[model samples]
Target chain A: MKAIVPIKRVVDPYAKVKPTADGAGLDSGGAKFEINPFDEIAVEEAVRQKEAGRFTEVVVVSVGKGECEEQLRKALAIGADRAVLLETQEPLDSPAVAKVLSEFVAAEAPHVVLMGKQATDDDNNQAGQMLAAILDWPQATFAAKTDFAADKATVVRETDSGEETLELPYPCLVTTDLRLNEPRYIALPGIIKARSKPLEKRPLASVPAPKSSVVSFAPAPARPPGRKVGSVAELAQAIKDRGVF
Target chain B: MSLLVICFDPSELSQVAGFGASFGTYDVLLLTGEAGNAGASKIHVANLVEVPPADNIGKSVASVAANYTHVAAVSSMRAKDLMARVAGINQSAMITDVVKVFSETEFERPMVAGSVLARVKAESTPIVMTFRPAGFDKTVPGPNGSVESISISDTGRVKRVSTSARQGGRPDLSQAKFVVSGGRPLKDAATFEQVIGGFADKFGAAVGATRAAVDSGIAPNDLQVGQTGKVVAPDLYIAAGISGSTQHMAGIKDSKLIVAINKDGDAPIFDQADLGIVGDLYEVLPELEKALS
Candidate 1:
C-alpha cells in the first residue's frame, strides 16, 4: 500500500497577518514561512502508517513556487521517502490547487491521498474534497478518528449531535483534521538524511491552470473592538442588549 | 439555503458579514447551518437543518434541501457530492466551489476552488454554486424567501454508496458542551495533559481546539473550534493557552460562558471571556479542579 501526502507553504500562523496595501490579500512580506501545520499532521499520519509497516512508500508532494521544496524536505526529514514539487509562481487558489493536485495524484495512483483539511494561508479548506470529487472517489472531511485496515478506512466524523463514522474504500481523498494526532519533530540527523533522498521538480506545463483568474483578492477588514466591557456577564448583557445575540 | 456559503468556523460567518455588507450589492439573507461564537444575530436569523438520525452525506443534504425550492444550494469547495446530489434532485446545478457570485440573472461560482470561475445562467430562478456564494449587502430580516416544499427526483447523475450499515467513526466536537482548548502557549502535549485533562474532567467537557494547535498536530481538527473547523456552543468554554484569533474565535463564539486561564494579560481570550483568570493553566487548573471538588 502507498500513501501520498500533499503539503503547502503558508504564512506562519504565529506572525501577525496584516492586510496587503490593496486590501485583497495578506501581506506576507518579512514574515516567516513554514510547512502548513495541518498538512504536517497528514504527513505525520502517513509516515506513522508506513513505519508500522501498515503501508509501503510515502510520497510528499508540494504545489507552490520552488520554495515549497524546503517544505517537502521537512516531510522527508519527518519520514517521507521521496519528494515531488509542482513548480509555479502564481498564487493558485483552492480550486486551481485541487485541479493541479488531481492531475498529479492520478499519475501517482497511490492507494490513498491525504492533505490538511485547509491551508492556513488561504483558509478555503476545499481542495481535498474537490480533488476527491474530480477523481470520482469518496471523500471525508473533519475526520477526528481514522483507522486503516483491510485496504479500507474507518473515519469518525463530526455531527451536530455526536460523532459518526464512515467506512470508505481505498484510493479516496482525505483531509486531516487538527485533533487527528500530534506531529513528530525532525531530528537533526533526519534533516541531513533528507538531502540524500531524491527530490523531483516538475513544471506546470503539464499541470492544468484554471482558465479564469481572480477578479479580486482582498484581506478581511479588522472588526471594531467589541465595546470592551468590564466583565463577561456584562459582555453577555451588552450583546443581548445590542441585539447581536 | 437561499444562497449558501460554507462556514466551518464562526469567524468565517463574520467575514461573510464583512464581505457581504461592505462589498456586497444585494439585499441577501445570511443563513448559517449553525451560528458560531457570535451566537444568534437578528441580522441573520440562522436556522438548524434536520438530518436523518443515521445517514450519509447525501441524505443529510437531501433532507435539508427538501425543505426549500432550492434555486441553488452553496456547498464547500470540498463537498465532493454536493452538486451531483443536487443534480440528482433534478435541480440543474451550476457547480463551482471556488469563490463565486450572482450575476443578476446568472450565478457565477468558481468551478475549481479559486482557479477558473464559471457562470451558470439560472433558467431556474434559484441557481446553486457549491463554493463561492455571493456577498450580501446586509442580512435582511424577512421571511425565508417563501420556501416551498419539494420532493427528491431521480436525475441519475451519480449516487454515493451508503455506509450507514457499518457506522464508521467521526468526531462531533461541534456539538460538545465543554471544550478544553489550547494555543501556541501550551508548548507540548505533555504539559497540556495536566491543564486540559483537569479542565475536561472537572467540567465534564470535551476538549476544544484552535487551528493553530490543530495544524501543529498537537490537537485534532475535530477538536478545533474556529472559522474553518467546527462551531461549538458549549456550556462552559475554557481556554488554557489560546490567544484568541479572530478566525479561531468563530468556533466558540456561541459558548455559554468562556473562561480564559493564561499567563499573558494581553491574550485576546480575555477580551471576550466572562471570567478572565490572569494566571497559568498549569497553576490555575489544578487549583480550579481542587476548588470544585
Candidate 2:
C-alpha cells in the first residue's frame, strides 16, 4: 500500500502573531515558518505503516511556495520514501489545496491518504475530509489508532468521552490525533542518507485548480484569555458557578 | 431571505461535512463554542446563541414550535432533545444545542477536544439538521453575506448566574516571541531555570518546555509545547533540546523562524529550522546568548 501525507507551511507556533495591518490576518513580519504540527503526526503514521511492513512506500506532499520543497525534503529525512511539492508561492485556501491534492492523489492512486486533523495556521481541520469528498471515499478523522491490512484499514478515533472505531476498505482518508504516536526523530546518519532520497516538485499549472475565489484573509479574533482557577476542582466549580460548561 | 438550513447533533462526528456539503445551497448558520466553533463558513451565518448543552431543539421548538419550517440538530448526546422536537409537541420544550433545523430530517455530531465531524441524511426537503463545526470549506468565504438574529427564545430554562473569571497570565512559551524552551537535555529543574530564566529575561520571551523536560516533574503543562498542549505561533521558535516529534510539533507550527540547537543535527526539529546549530545546546545557548548580548 502507498500513502500520501499532506502537510502545510505555516507560521511557527512560537511566534507571536500580531493582528495584521487591517486586523484581518496574522502579521508575518520576521516570523518563523514550519510544517503544520499535525502534519508531522500524519507523516509519522504513514512511515509507521511502512516500518510495520504493512506498506511499501510513503510520500509526503505539501502545497505552498517553492520553499516547500525544503519542507518536503525534511519529511524525506524522517523516513517518507518520496516527496511532492505542489509549488504555490502564495498561501491557499482549503479548497484550493484540496483540489491540487486530489489531482495528485488521482494520478498516484495511493491506497491511503493521511493528514493532520487540522492545520495550525487557520485551525480549519477539513482539508483531508474535503479531499475525501472530492474523491468520494470514506473518511476517518481524529484517528487515535489505525491498523492497516490487505486492502482494508480499521481505525479507532479517541473521542472526548471514549473512542469510535470504524472498519473501511483501503483508498480512504485518515486524519490523526496528537496521541496517535510519539513521532520519532530522524537520526543524524539518516539525515545524511535522506539527502539521497527522491524529491518531486509539481507546479500549480500542472494540476487543475479549484473553481473558487478567496474573498478575504484575516487572523482569528483574539480569544480573551480564558480564566484559570487554582486547580481542576476550582476550574470545575467555576464551570458550575457560571452554568456555562 | 432566501435560505435553507439544517440542524443536527452538534456533537456528532459528521456535523462538519454535512454543514460543508449543504453550505453552498443557501445561507449557512453554524452553532458552536462551549461546543466546537461550528458554523464558520466564510460565506455563512454566525449567531452563536448562548444555550445549554443539547437543548437547542427543545428551546427552538418551545419558542417557535409554530414556525415549524425545519430544524436540524444532533442525536448523539442530545437524543432526548431531537425526540422532543419531532414528538409532535409544541409548548413544552427543553433547551438543546440544535445545530440546524430545516424540516423533519435531523443530524448528529461527535467531537473530540476540538475536531468536529457530523453525520447527516435524516430526511428530505425542508431539511432541518445542525451545522457541524468545521464541517464545511471555511477558509474560503462563499459570497457576500450578513448576520441577522432571529430572537427565537421565550421558554428560557437556565438563568444567568454569578460569574467568576480570573485574569490569565502571558500566553505560554509556545506563544512567546523569544521562547526559552527546554527539553530532556536539561539535566534537572534547577538547571532548567538557570538557562531558561536568563533567556526569557534577556529576550522578554516566555518560557516553554518539551514533554520530556516536563516529565522530569520540573515544569508544568502550561509550559509544555507539543501536539496535545498549546499550539504556539510565535515570531522566532527555538528548539533547545527537543527532537521535534509531530506531537510536539502541534504546539509550534505557526512560528516564523525556527532555530534548532541540539547535539544531533539530524533531529526532526532541524528540518523545520531556518538555522540549525549542530552543537550541544548546553554549549550553544550561552554562546548564542553572548552573541545576542
Fnat of all models, as shown: 0.02, 0.00
User: Residues B182-268, candidate 1, lDDT per residue (tens digit)?
Assistant: 876667656555567545756556766677775675654445576565556666677778888767774565566676767878887
Model 2 off-target regions past 4 Å? A187-189, A206-245, B1-5, B10-293
User: What shift in Å separates residue B62 of candidate 2 from its native position after superposition?
Assistant: 28
In terms of lDDT, the poorest run of 10 residues in model 2 chain A is A220-229
**Model 1 chain A worst lDDT run, 10 consecutive residues:** A219-228
| lDDT agreement of model 2 with the native | 0.55
lDDT of 2 by residue, B1-293 (tens): 12333332233323344444453333333333222333333222233454332222344533332334443333222232232333223211111222333323333322212122122232223223333232233233333244443443323222222222211333334225557687888888788878876666676777788877765656543466764444455666667888877557545654555667778766877666555666777776776665554
Candidate 2 lDDT, tens digit per residue, A51-166? 99997999888987888776677788888998878786655555557767888899999999999877665454546655765675566666768889895788766432234555
Per-model DockQ: 0.13, 0.02
